[model samples]
Target: MDQPTRQRRGLLIVLSSPSGAGKSTIARMLLESDKDVTMSVSATTRPKRPGEVDDLDYHFVDDAGFDAMIDEGDFVEWAPVFGYRYGTPKAPVKDALREGRDILFDIDWQGTQQLEAAMGEDLVSIFILPPSMNELEHRLRSRGTDSDEVIADRMSRAASEISHWPEYEYVLVNRDMDQCVAQVRAIVAAERLKRTRRIGLVTFVRDLIGPAH
Candidate 1:
């Protein structure tokens, strides 16, 4: 069987938030629902969590390996957060974009900045915040992955992260998980309909005009 032609003109979605602000959850759902979209796997210096496979949850690498890629200009964006380094590779994302498949990023604000600088107009940025500070604290504590001290530190850092909401094109209050996911899906749908991303649509329009009489 012949393979289908790759898509053209994809979206670059930047979904950013504090450690426990639900950006990751929404990103996962978006990926699940949309065949045209996929996550931009990040390269991290941190060790893989249990059952985490490379190139899935993250691409775990050694310092020297990551640094070598950095020196080679292999990352579209990179940042050092909480003692661990993380970066978005330059190639896969670009290739996905060229093939007309949208890529979602679950990075923090700093990484989003680098992506914006790199992808420019191709980027669609969103910031997610908890319903309130109390709720955020609660969510962080409930995760059970980090200790009290770590959770406290994360909550403290969250304030700074949430302050950057105005910078995002879309701000979502993750009060209700399903609703927020729907809202995000709607945004993606609208973005996909954007004229600039529809090269074929331009040709379709010209055809509609019937050779300019």
Candidate 2:
């Protein structure tokens, strides 16, 4: 006989890496390919960039609004970043998880630490690493998006970000995009099967096995 369907609680999937390490690219690929996983839109005081949609790209709010949410305990975790404040709202994430829809977070190591403290076992964290420092600098320059000074600043910050690799449960060296994405997908698949995540497994198995006879 076929097994009964077991219910599962959704996972909070987090991916962290320094700029130009292809973290954002991997995240985009995952969101595009996986129907069950969705990005966790954060609330931020920063102005929306070109082509960024409100609530989709980010829930852009003002300083006053951000402070009000902070005061009301609306955020799971929040921190000042670059001259602005950014945070993941508590309600939507919890709702999604209860509905068995996985949520993806693309945040820095500091934010990852905060989320780990707040969400604990619900979170699965991964860190992406550049193949080498030279390759990292090359990728940053190849973008042609920033001036030399900005690139230098990013390189300096990359060292600090990479130092937190030990904090993640999984680490991937992004030498090739396709392979890196495959590895991440495999991790997500395996994590979904973890015994703790499947809430209804005991009943499903008991039904399959029959009552002690």
Clashing pairs in 2: none
Q: Please list the C-alpha lDDT of all candidates, in the order they appear.
A: 0.87, 0.92
Relative to the true structure, candidate 1 reaches a TM of 0.93
Listed in order, each prediction's TM-score against the native is 0.93, 0.95
Candidate 2 positional error at 198, Å: 0.8
lDDT per residue, candidate 1, 82-185, as tens digits? 99999999999889888888999888889988898989788999899888889888888888888999988998899898888888999988999999999999
Q: What is the C-alpha lDDT profile of model 2 across 1-213, one tens digit per residue? A: 434344688999999999999999999999998998999999999999999999999999999999999999999888877678899999998998898889999988878998999888999999999999999999999999999999999999999999999999999999999999999999999988888888887778788778794
lDDT for position 93 in model 2: 86
Clashes of 2: 0
Lowest lDDT 10-residue stretch of candidate 1: 1-10
Best by TM-score: 2
Q: What residue runs in model 2 are displaced by over 4 Å at the alpha carbon?
A: 1-4
The total of clashing pairs for model 1 equals 2
Residue 173 of model 1 has an lDDT of 88
How well does candidate 1 match the true structure, expressed as C-alpha RMSD?
Answer: 3.0
Which lDDT value does model 1 have at 149? 91
